[model samples]
Target chain A: MSVTAAKGFTAAGIAAGIKENGNPDLALVVNNGPRRAAAGVFTSNRVKAAPVLWSEQVLKSGQVSAVVLNSGGANACTGPKGFQDAHATAEKVAEVLGRGAVEVAVCSTGLIGLLLPMDKLLPGVETAAAQLSEHGGEKAAIAIKTTDTVHKTSVVTKDGWTVGGMAKGAGMLAPGLATMLVVLTTDAGLENDVLDEALRAATRTTFDRVDSDGCMSTNDTVLLLASGASGVTPDHAEFAEAVRQVCDDLGQQLIRDAEGASKDIKIEVINAATEDDAVEVGRSIARNNLLKCALHGEDPNWGRVLSAIGTTRAAFEPDRLNVAINGVWVCKNGGVGEDRDKVDMRYREVHIVADLAAGSETATIWTNDLTADYVHENSAYSS
Target chain B: MSVTAAKGFTAAGIAAGIKENGNPDLALVVNNGPRRAAAGVFTSNRVKAAPVLWSEQVLKSGQVSAVVLNSGGANACTGPKGFQDAHATAEKVAEVLGRGAVEVAVCSTGLIGLLLPMDKLLPGVETAAAQLSEHGGEKAAIAIKTTDTVHKTSVVTKDGWTVGGMAKGAGMLAPGLATMLVVLTTDAGLENDVLDEALRAATRTTFDRVDSDGCMSTNDTVLLLASGASGVTPDHAEFAEAVRQVCDDLGQQLIRDAEGASKDIKIEVINAATEDDAVEVGRSIARNNLLKCALHGEDPNWGRVLSAIGTTRAAFEPDRLNVAINGVWVCKNGGVGEDRDKVDMRYREVHIVADLAAGSETATIWTNDLTADYVHENSAYSS
Candidate 1:
């Protein structure tokens, strides 16, 4: 159970003949609620996808009865015709579900610059609505995968309410949003404003910090819907913590399942002048291809870390900086410290701590190593 | 002849026992001039190498008698001892050449965070000074190789004047300077201020735009020395053009010899709102890992180009964006246009043009395709 774990929700996933390889390409989630409330976040990339534009408008009404997602085409950079297609998709879903089009959201993922196969997708919406079930959450999670090797879902329960979510992403992952589609559900009887505040506060530190590739996408969207089935309006802080926990779990899953990744790196920047500075330093370290390659080879190259930090405008003194790899302080006071050979790196997880020595702020960024397999996977992806 | 193509320049290269493999690791280039006028540029990286710090201070006087370069260790991130070593190397070079220590510049390249072998290096400087000859430019070029497969040199001869240079760099290349050491010799009877203006203008469009792997180095230095032996006093514009030509040639050589690169890509952004905008967009396209990998596989994935453009704050509308790969406009009006199959990419040189349709400014950046070999080379480089 993903969305349905929170109660008062049903979902369906089906093959819509949109994918040439006959993979499941369509998913629908519906809220059978005494009250409907929703919040959403989209990619900050200026060139947004057609479904992103449609869903952004639907979310403005602060109510969502259903969400339809497909994984065979991104429907991005497709011009006005693509936006029209997204609107048409929402209308079709509304017709099948007996709801207003404004209460339905649409999402798409996969190859950009191609129009979706409406002929197969429109009829599949009826078939999916006819098969809606509480157990269909897992299938819905699986249907949104593009290069993801496994479906990701996480849940957190309180005394009387719960929050759960599913995410799909593997490559082209970065900040503002990764190239992903996420749907979260809650039965905490919260209004749209409360949901919006909690969702924003939770995602700010969770999904927004995952910078796997430093590549922002045009079709990233995350959404949350409340059904009020539990009828318990919990404290805002507790509900927000649950949302953050689920989002953090899903983000970890995204990083662990990153494309062709051999190692998952966690860069933590400490003693920064401000949170923004810490984030800047963390992102710079996360995006350094040379450093990533060095980490992949298990070389404790502190110089690459220093070079990455030098490129940022964060507040830090070069001679006062320090770096630790795998809990070994390989560099201290901007120079060689402990013996690098003593650091063990045979594990799949690598942790790098960069001390800015400026103030008392910290931020963490998650990334993966640069490997030959990454080049191979991306080089042959479109062809 | 390389630097010796110009008058009043003598150079020598020798195996200094600094490299374990007995490869040539020390080079000395002396400007035997009646008038010694020089200008230099160093890496903008805040965490600069000890050699870079030493050379930057020497260049402040607008006079340089000689340049000493080594390839065994970068002498970076080594703290106070490294700075003393760099100073000692310069002092030894000045003593051997019978000049003041302030007139000698030292450069180093290799793995960072290691101290130089002063015992071998100081003795090698004396030997290099004794063996300096007008025909040693080729050997001097060969001595500075790190991962470079071949030596790089360029020369431009004009009426009674010549500008020539030698460069060494194979990896860790990006804007604000590549991981390179360049020494330019000119016998055109120019002042340090004139040479400074000319060198800055030349590098701005040439070396500063070559962004391979988007990884800046801590040990980049470019120096130009004028001997004033030709007695021509040629037109300033003509001399500047000659300097730019030589710099452009050397920059091209560096790109062609970029480590593990199989294809050279020229990204030209046209019709931008400003030249800065064009440069920003061009650099963004040049540094896109997905686009580079796709180009390596000969796939005209125009969507990646659009996606890269979307990430920048440059002035361009999504629908008005167009991209052409290898002379075929694969993406027009931000969507699919001409057939991608028509864009032939079967050559070692790949050309990409992004039309912003915003203004009339233009800029070009040179980069290389990402390959498995790049990962292999950089991953095992320092290990």
Candidate 2:
């Protein structure tokens, strides 16, 4: 079941002439509420997009009824007009759905700093809202993508509760809480405070740990809307765990689909002085492009790995650190230990384990190998 | 005139058995001064090579008479024995020069965490000392290269003084400095404190600002040695300026020879509220692989530029950001303005200007385009 399969939600996607390719560019998702509890996470980048700023303010109410997203023009750095365009989109959505304009949220992705073609957008929202249906999650996922080869959707079912989500992102992925645009829906009865707490906790570990290319986006956001339609609120702990699993699954898919990526790499930092240190070490390695490229080539260049980990301020002595790639111990007690040729990287998945030997804490980060395709795709992205 | 041109200095480069290619992998430089005075800068990475730690300790006295470098093994994370190897190298150099071991420094770069081949290294040092000469800067530069296609050397001549240097690095380059190994010599009468101050200031603006691949190295070191042989001491201001020019020239050379780089990019962040903010903004843009790749493809994707700028903590409203590429104003006040066709990126050099509209502070960072060759070269770097 897709995200829209959740009770009390309807979604629609449509072509709006915003893209020159005539692909679908508008998506609308509405909460058929038994409850309107909602929470959101936005990009931490100080330079934010117009739609991000607007949504951040709207989310202050901790309540939302609908979301309107458009792809093709990011509506970022478009000055005051960009904000106006976002508000106008919300107003149009509210007008069509007979709801307050403030109850609608907006997101835009594609090229940044370009004015959204209002001529195509206004009518497109009306069409999307009118065509909204219970099974439109897949279409909505496909509409809000640029350069992504496929749509990403996930669902989790419990005894009496269910959680579902859709995500869209191909590049500009990094840490800052939420790294991309993800919309989650649930039929379990949940309070606003509980949903907010759970989302923050899940995001801190899941979406926040995916670093595809270490480029943070201006429009990254994640929103969760709980309809309480099932009237069977599971234990808060169970719901939170389920939410994390959904996010983890979708995050993995995003990494798999990273632009020009051939392999997905998982870096685990263990025996750290603290959880934060472990995460910092993992992130340091995940963001190193040279190491990532080396992984793509299947070269167990532990030197690059050591160099990456050394860049972080995490507490660890170089001599005590241990490194293993693909389960082969390449270095032990800070020195070469295993034959590099014994480690193989022919598969699409790669794992690297770094032992800090300082404490007991551990953390893992997911990333993709840097490839020539990534360079080729990005170099001509704006052209 | 090069680094070795300084009076009271003898240098040599020779091929040791460390590298499989049989390239020149060992180098020796000695400061033939009545009173040795030196200052060094090492990589800020927390994970340091064994030689780095050893040298860092040996440089505490601010007096170094000799430096030994090898380019086939990093000797990092090799535990206590690695430290012994570095000390032994220094002892060997000192013994041949008839000086104390404490007065010599050591550096290594190449594969990390591998034990030094003491059998080959000991004999190689003796040969290097026997062959040391005044005009060995060219060979010394070649000795410390890994993937670099050419040697990098720079010299500056003032009214009564001269400063010259050589460097080796072609990959694993980024802010917080690149994976560079540099040796500088000056035929100027200066105190240890003065030389340290000049080196710091020069490096902050030059080597510290060139980020080729955003990967910090564990064995980055830049050492400056001053000889009173010239008997011509100039004002501190003049000496500092000369040092800056030499560093700038070498830094540019490094960028020109960066791996697989089709274009050298200069990113300028102006009108920032503070120098730190300006640098942060400039570095953010320089480190964006997507933007670098876009520059390679000659696409004026200003959206990517603004998006990269948005990732920094600089104080600027998204709408007020102005960006120009290749002298053409592609984005003004945060929105698309001039015709993108007017911006041409066909040349090997590209300039990007970002106006923060905050204040007067500014910073410039140098970088290279991301290409397929970068991936291909780095993938097999260790093997």
- Who wins the TM-score comparison? 1
Cα lDDT tens digits, model 1, A125-207, are: 99899989988899999888888999999989899898988899997889998889999999889999999999998888988
Tens-place lDDT digits, model 1, residues B139-243: 999999988999999999999999999999886779999989999999999999899999999999999999998888999999999999998898999999999
CA lDDT of each candidate? 0.92, 0.86
Please provide TM-scores, in order, for all candidate models, with all chains considered together.
Answer: 0.99, 0.96
The ten-residue window of minimal lDDT in model 2 chain B covers B374-383
TM-score of chain B of each: 0.99, 0.98
lDDT of 2 at B377: 85
- Global CA lDDT of candidate 2, please? 0.86
User: How would you class the docking of model 2?
Assistant: medium
User: How close to the true structure is residue B178 of candidate 1, measured as C-alpha lDDT?
Assistant: 91
Model 2 chain A: lowest-lDDT 10 consecutive positions: A171-180
